[model samples]
Target: MEVAIAAAAVVAMGTGNRVLYKLALVPLREYPFFLAQFATFGYVVVYFSILYLRYQAGIVTDEMLSLPQKPFLVVGLLEAFAAAAGMAAGAVLSGASIPILSQTYLVWQLLLSAIFLKRRYRINEIAGCFLVTVGVIITVASGSGTSASFKSTGILWPLLMIISFFLQAADTVLKEIIFLDASKKLKCGSVDLFVVNSYGSAYQALFMCLLLPFLSKLWGVPFRVLPTYIKDGAACFLNMGSISGCEGAPLLPLLFVLVNMGFNISLLHLLKISSAVISSLASTFSVPLSIYAFTLPLPYIGVASSLPPGFVAGAAVLTAGLLLYSLPQARHFGNTFSQQK
Candidate 1:
């Protein structure tokens, strides 16, 4: 039941993210510079405020805020940059051959955790990682398009997209470490889940605001880019709602936002209740599944066109790998059950 719930939550999050991106982030392209930031920060403030209130009520703790300042800030900035770049890249690459750039941060997290966090992976974990890689490779390599397209163009925009994907992966690992470490130290209940995420988002929003001028100057782009992106995002989210027959729905975005919040909270909770490996694996499954679900209807757009026989074959291979990876872990638990019996 818990697994079911977790999978459902992740699916909801994956679906919501794509929809919200389409509705919210794509429309704010025409707004003023600071106004875009204001909208973003405003949303963050509201989201985090709910978490803050929970903490103030003794439902969580201040220790959630006791993260190492430098690393946290750096990671936050990386996350913001990755997010902006990824969205922008997706927009630019929308009509291209490869639409979905499956940023498997879970795989990166597993590797980083093993190296830095001294995480010891069982055979099952190792197998799972292999499966994930195989699946991704199959999905990417076998799907379609020329090998040249897969090759890096050395162009600024595509390079940024690739960088964004990598940075987002790093950010996921950083987040998992920070939140998990904080929860262990604080020994708080699940409420800290809300508090920690809320703080992270708030911090990221502030950091993004601070970096705006530098980013604009560095890229020789107008500060207007920020508003334009925001408007674009907003319009995308609104359109998603409309397409889903949620037109003029007052709380749809809010609901979607909360669902996203729920996803993070659930992920944090899962990390506590289970191993990071398990959490990562579960999260990884959502990525391809989301692509499959969302792209099935619009088979002509983006990565959908590539969903030919080879893509399906690759997806199958990936699924087989996931199963292979789970076998050892399952056996270990099964042995424990047998001993008890």
Candidate 2:
């Protein structure tokens, strides 16, 4: 039962994340890039502030303020960069047959948890990791229906995608560490989770703004002042006219932003209810879900090309590996929770 609930939470979070990204974050069409960044940060701040206020009102504990400063900021920057780079790469290599590399983070998380956090896993857990790795390799190697055949000359783009995504996993591990530390120190219940996350978002927003000038110069674009960007963003937020030269904006993207916010909230709630390891593992399910989602005909990318029977067979084998890995952990988690109860 515990396993079922955990798995359900994972699946729900995964689905929510997909919806959020597709619906919310993708919308805001006419805003400056920096404005979008601020919006993202503002959303986080609002969410966290609500939690903190609740805590102060005796609805949650106050220890939420104990979040570590340095490590959290450092990890946040890494995560931000990874995210930005990966998004760019995904846009560039939409249907390329580069191995779906995000799961590499699972291995990194497991290792970091074991080494620095002193978290121990049974042999079965290790076995689960191995199976997941194999599954990833199989899934990638089999190639998706939409997958572009590998080209030696054009490999650099996909390779960069893999590297950025690997860094994303590393960021995930670091985030988990920060969250775990804050949780342990604050003991103010789940309220602290929201607070820490919100502050982290704020930090990332500031960091991005500061770095934007340099990035603009590098890309050979004129740098806009932060305040100017914010003013333009606020106008967009207020439903006023967009800045000059900006394309007309739509409401759908704003709706998507709300959806993304919900997704983040749901994810944090899951984290409050469960271990980071479980949350991380559950997130892996997203890759498969995303593949399935992208298979449909859409505005940006059309339906995936049909695959041969061999590819289908390979996919099944890969899925079997994933199931083999997760089953043991699920069973063990159930038994452990039962004993504790």
- Each model's Cα RMSD: 5.9, 5.4
By how many angstroms RMSD does model 2 differ from the true structure? 5.4
Candidate 2 is scored at a TM of 0.70
Q: Write the per-residue lDDT of candidate 1 for residues 30-132, one digit (tens) a residue.
A: 3223333554576577767777687678765666556466656766688788767765665445323233344345556667778767887777557767777
Model 1 residue 29 distance off true place after TM-score fit, in angstroms: 8.1
Q: Which digits, one per residue and each the tens of the lDDT, describe model 2 over residues 1-341?
A: 66547556666657655644443323334444544565566676686778768777876554545445777687668766765666556555644343455555677677767877788877666676666556545554555543444453277767767677666666656666666665566555343556656766766766766666654443334575645655665665445674443322345445445556655665555555664566666666554555555555534233454443344454454555456555543335643643221
- The alpha-carbon lDDT assigned to residue 51 of candidate 1 equals 70
Could you tell me the lDDT of residue 336 within candidate 2?
A: 68
In model 2, the runs with Cα more than 4 Å from the true position are 1-7, 19-39, 87-99, 133-163, 182-184, 187-191, 214-251, 295-322, 327-341
lDDT of 1 at 138: 61
- Model 1: lDDT equals 0.57
Cα TM-score per model: 0.70, 0.70
Model 1, runs deviating above 4 Å: 1-4, 23-43, 62-71, 84-104, 140-146, 155-162, 187-191, 213-221, 224-259, 275-277, 295-307, 328-341
